[model samples]
Target: MAGSHGGSLKSWLAVIVILAGFTVGGVALCFGPNWPLVWAGAGIIAVGGVIALLVDIFSDVIVDAPRVLASEKVDRKG
Candidate 1:
């Protein structure tokens, strides 16, 4: 079954960015000043924003590209 995450490249990148942010946050909390909370919060927000941006870009590209769908099997999977 197609659970949740379809495993699109964009989704993977988003996951990577979020994980990186948490890793950085961990380091910051351990060594840096209290600003890590602010930094991490902002970083998470920024990552979410970029993911949205990429979705927009992907949708634009999909729309602009030439394609014809005849059935559910022919639809864009990602």
Candidate 2:
């Protein structure tokens, strides 16, 4: 039976990124004076959250690799 996590290492990395974005965004919203930086952090958090959500939902489809057949190999005459 296939386990829950069918995504690649990159997907996991994305999750990490999302967490970091949320953390940074929260901190910026709490402490940053400038509105632009706050908005940028919020945007980053939103984008990262969406990507992580998609990755988790479609992990299998996202990470599935095509099977290669031995007969598909081309032999070089060199």
| Index of the highest-lDDT prediction | 2
- Identify the runs in model 2 with alpha carbons over 4 angstroms from their true place: 1-7, 32-34, 46-57, 61-78
Can you write out model 2's per-residue Cα lDDT over 1-78, one digit (the tens) per residue? 133334576576666776777777677778856667667777777787787777673544443356676777678998
Give the alpha carbon lDDT tens digit for every residue of 1-78 in model 1: 133324566655766776777777776777755685759756885886698577653443222334577765556778
Scored by TM-score, the top model is 2
TM-score, per-candidate, Cα-based:
0.45, 0.46
At residue 23, candidate 1 shows an lDDT of: 71
Residue clash pairs of candidate 2 = none
Candidate 1 wrongly placed segments (more than 4 Å): 1-6, 34-41, 52-78
Native-to-model Cα distance after best TM-score fit, residue 53 in candidate 1, in Å: 7.1
lDDT of 2: 0.67
